[model samples]
Target: MGQNISFNGTTGVNNDTERRIHIPLYFRILSVIEIPVMILTLVALCAVIKSQRSAPVFVIHLILSDFIQIICKLMITSEWIREVDAIFPILPDAFDYSLIAGLYFMACVAFERYLLVSHPIWYKSHHSLKVSCVVSVIVWFVPLIFTFSKYFDSLSVPIGCLIPYPIIILCFVGTRRGLSHAISLTSLKRKLILGRLFLVLLTYTFLIFPIVIMWFFSQIFPQFMFSSFSDVLYFFSHLMFLNPIADCLLYLFMRPDAGDLMKSVCCCCRTDTHQNSTHSRDEHSRDSRATFACCVSVQNPASHSQTACSSV
Candidate 1:
């Protein structure tokens, strides 16, 4: 009777089980290092918001997403959670979703900077805290949809990952072009915007793009690559852990205090004495002008003094 009631062949299931790879010691070590960094980043972000009395809405969301991703990664790599993951395999999906959200938030930040540079008036009028909050909410939800759909269709995951790359590149290019023509933003402001955009682009290219490319290829040729190159894909996926650490640099770039510190450190060769000397020269020039005006006023009568002082 048991033989008569034949189940689906066991060969595919056995093959899949064999293909399952264990989390390496290196990834676990990386996760241990990442947790403290993410915590410090979160604290710094909150401190910046509190001290400045202004929240960088997109950056806040991006950091939150990174924190979530790091937590999910730690959960996945933890030995204690193996049984829970087997019972309910949701942590991996959660990690993927958080990663996607982080990508979107990065794009949002780049686009916001681009708007500020390219269309200052429009950005000033239309871009408000409320609008940013709404946009961040929307960004958070969009990934859920994609991650859910990814279970039904493998291609959806890669497509979702691929979408942000071009948006970021376009923002970086637009910002570079606008910086050349921008008159409203100061040199330091323009430099910060360009630097942030460049950093985002670089992060995506080096740390995130490899996993995306491997995922895309594995999805496209699942039978061939997924079976043959599963270990390679797993190795590339671990590279993503570096992203949250790299993201701390964004906070440094965003913080005014950090930027000032960086400038001071870079210009440490210029002595305080030189600055005092310049200040003294400026004071002497002002005093000389005042003396010249007083002499002119004294040389002329009251009626002519008004015209003479005005001319001086």
Candidate 2:
């Protein structure tokens, strides 16, 4: 007597023990495309950070997460002998959790910007570098716990969706509000930053939603998990990986300072190095003189007395 089995509607002649997990060829191809894009994004982000004196810590964290995800994806998509056991026991879970954690960081960044622009006084008073570092640790750690838990897939999904999705929606609404109220040059710049951020979030959400929907269905109906729909899921999964590269491009175009840094690296319209050095020194001296003048004005008792008298 013989028993027949099928998985995802595809029938194959193999014993239960012979059945093994395998990655599709197309999925592996998509990963190959994603890897180079991520590498380029990482390089661009590094260049931006190097040139900027006060780059956001979140950007650094985002890049690190992207790098880790790329590595994990490579492992997942690599060609290998399929065994009844997991090919790499840890890569799949790590990939999902790390990606989700990175999404949390992106949400935090959006929220921080919203606060900074909408409530500048409060943001300045409450924001701390040390506190940001602590929060980053918490963000990365929270997802890992779920990944390692017995209910890994079933439990992590809803929380992952709840946290970042609403936060990003709030960020979107808050930024719009901030833009409407903004009048000053600085405020306008903040609006631009928020606009770029909104684009990044929106793009990420759109690309990842297909996978989320598929995952939601899969959890409830395990039979549907790796069906024909999986081919579509793989495409979206690759698109989701493109978010980091999208982020880099968005930063380059939307942030003027970062654009200038990239341009400088490309040596666009290059001038003589000696002339550039001389010009920088001159600019520094002019800034120093202006600062000294401002200090002198503040130090003058006569000016202070005159202003006090005039006010009265």
Candidate 3:
């Protein structure tokens, strides 16, 4: 029997156990790696919160969006595998907005980095806390304006929610282009480092570009044209979890300060670990030496070397 993804086209789409669930192997492979990705997100959020880092405020939002995505993925895995209800209830689409907020934060982080790197003076002079507060309000409110879908089933194009998208694309592209040109005149080693960072930023935008196209197509083709692809679109949306790895890569390669800090932390951890191991070995050796010395003292009843014996 040929399978279709829609169920009466009213509220829910019945995804094919074979087609939809077949899930391109790439996606499945990526999904398998999400556990550590989820953990990294929690740890990163906590670390950012405890310490006042540049753009730490947006880190909370980014982590939250990724967290929501992790929850959504878990739900998808469970709901699909368990085969519960065969149909999900129509619920408030809070996750929808949250995912968009995630994209917004992704752009926010990129530009934030660009500003700090390319125009530190301008960012410090103008992009202060007051401006950030206003900018955040704008980011949140724009999405709310386009919550046109009454419920999950009737979900419509989130039109007003995306006005900032072009600006985001521009900011990402412009920043990269500017950085590339500036780095070109520099030494080869610096250019290579900058090249790697640019690729990381480029990949971040690459993951985001699909959603932007989805929005454009939803507007152009009308809902009935292809609603079945929505869930797949939703899944592709979660791939931003890879951003942490990308962010870390860029940090290790491009940002010397961040790389140094990470190196220091890792070295400190290794040093502590090594010291603990060394101390344990020393303790064991000391105990053996003491036992042997005591035995010798008892047997020999007196040794000139006893004076040299000492407890560490």
Candidate 4:
């Protein structure tokens, strides 16, 4: 968020020259790109909600995080309708802080994947519905704890944002070991799984990694880095334009058979209800017949247990 540090502390284009260089630049980048990201998030959200499976839910969260980042970028890039920037000293910083929340969303997705692939059965059995809700909250909160001040400059930039960088950097782009458990497969299954891995790696590289780098550069050489890279970085910044489009394409179009695990829970619940209802009816009928037989035996002393039956 560092700018040319005008003689005045208020942020603005220093002059027509600087304005030409930077004003409306990053905003333009975000405005053009965010539409697609929003679209992708909605599409993926639909797919995941429809199925409620662990994998699809994770995908939805990732898309949502991307969407939020897109919004932060788009909002910052948007030209003000009035004199807000003149009044608000921290507008740009606000947008950047929101974007930090977006980064945490991605980290959550990666961790969820780790659980799903690393311990599928455990995730399926013990990672209850409540756990999902809790994790979602923590994902957003953890990043804020780490990066909010850095994003806002409301406080001195803390060191935690720096610590995660190396971890994020060292992450495997291609997963030779994404999943430890076996996914049932046919001849073509392995190929499709590999292809999906490749696409995921590409998405991380094309959309995520560059943004992180730009953030790094912006921090290191705040003014010059943003000034020099502003044009291309704003436009291409981790393919901001591609997110929604890719999200819709990959999540909805590509994986039609994606099952929602939540729905499975519902279905199972329904079956249990039906079985219990049927069992209760059978038990009631048996009790009624036994009572009728007992009465008949008392009255006529010749009731046959074999023929005992209730009319109802």
Best by lDDT: 1
Q: Could you give me the TM-score of model 1 versus the true structure? A: 0.75
Candidates arranged by lDDT, highest first: 1, 2, 3, 4
RMSD of each: 14.3, 18.0, 12.3, 17.7
Q: What are the lDDT scores of the predictions, listed in order?
A: 0.74, 0.62, 0.52, 0.50
- Compared with the true structure, the alpha-carbon lDDT of candidate 3 equals 0.52
Give residue 80's lDDT in candidate 3 (0 to 100): 57
Query: How would you encode candidate 4's per-residue C-alpha lDDT over 1-312 as one tens digit per residue?
Result: 345331111243233455544545644665566666567556656665556544445455556655654554444445462346563444444444444444444444444444545556786797755677677666666555544454465222223333434433333332336532345543243344444444544555576556555555555665564444655454444354464454444463236453343346568999999999999999999999999978878887433533464422
lDDT accuracy of residue 241 in candidate 3: 46
Write one digit per residue (lDDT tens) for candidate 1, span 260-290.
7667865774777689889999999999999
Stretches of candidate 3 off by over 4 Å are 1-14, 20-32, 45-55, 80-92, 117-119, 126-138, 149-165, 176-201, 222-256, 259-312
Per-residue alpha-carbon lDDT of candidate 2 for residues 118-158, written as tens digits (9 for 90 to 100): 88789878777676778888888877665666253464543
lDDT string for model 3 (1-312, tens) is 002221111123334555345434434466567556656655654564455434355545555665555454445444353455543332123445655666576567656756755775787788765676677767766545344342332234334325446655666566666666564344444344345445535755566555556555544555453555767555544454465444433323333255466567779999999999999999999999999988878787545455557531
In model 2, the Cα lDDT at residue 49 comes to 55
* Residue 304 error, candidate 2, Å: 81
Q: Estimate each model's TM-score.
A: 0.75, 0.64, 0.53, 0.56
Cα miss at 12, model 3 (Å)?
Answer: 8.0
- For model 4, the run of ten residues with the poorest summed lDDT: 5-14
